[model samples]
Target: MSIAVQDLEAQVLGLPPEDRARLLERLIASFEPRSKAQEAWMQLALRRQEDVRSGKAAMVPGR
Candidate 1:
């Protein structure tokens, strides 16, 4: 990795957990802003995740 990247990574690592998470999210989003279809899928995924967390859905082991 380049020195600039190493420096930036070190600086980011020194940030608080919340700041690090926020930065990570922003960095990921910067790569590709979600399209409407992607946004809908993300919403669905979040709902499904909540359902699983709430015991409304169960995980099945795959063979």
Candidate 2:
């Protein structure tokens, strides 16, 4: 990786857990959608993520 990217990575890695998670969400949002269908799926997944994070949903273990 280039020096600038390396430096940025180091800085991001140094962030606290909550700050890193916030940055991660922003990074994921910055990606261009591949298609409308895929974008809709991603939006659903993000909502589910929020539900779990907010204690409105629970994850089930696979059998």
Top lDDT prediction, candidate number: 1
* lDDT of model number 2: 0.91
TM-score, each model? 0.63, 0.48
Per-residue CA lDDT of model 2 for 4-58, tens digit only, reads 9889999999999999999998889779547899889989999999999999999
Q: How close is candidate 2 to the true structure, as a TM-score?
A: 0.48
Residue range 1-63, candidate 1, lDDT tens digits:
457988899999999999999999999999998899999999999999999999999978999
Please give the range of 10 consecutive residues that has the lowest summed lDDT in model 2. Answer: 25-34
List candidate 2 segments past 4 Å from native: 1-33
lDDT of 1: 0.94
Error of 1 at 30 (Å): 1.1
Instruction: Please report, in order, the local distance difference test score of every candidate based on alpha carbons.
Output: 0.94, 0.91
Error in Å for residue 61 of model 2: 0.5
lDDT of 2 at 34: 72
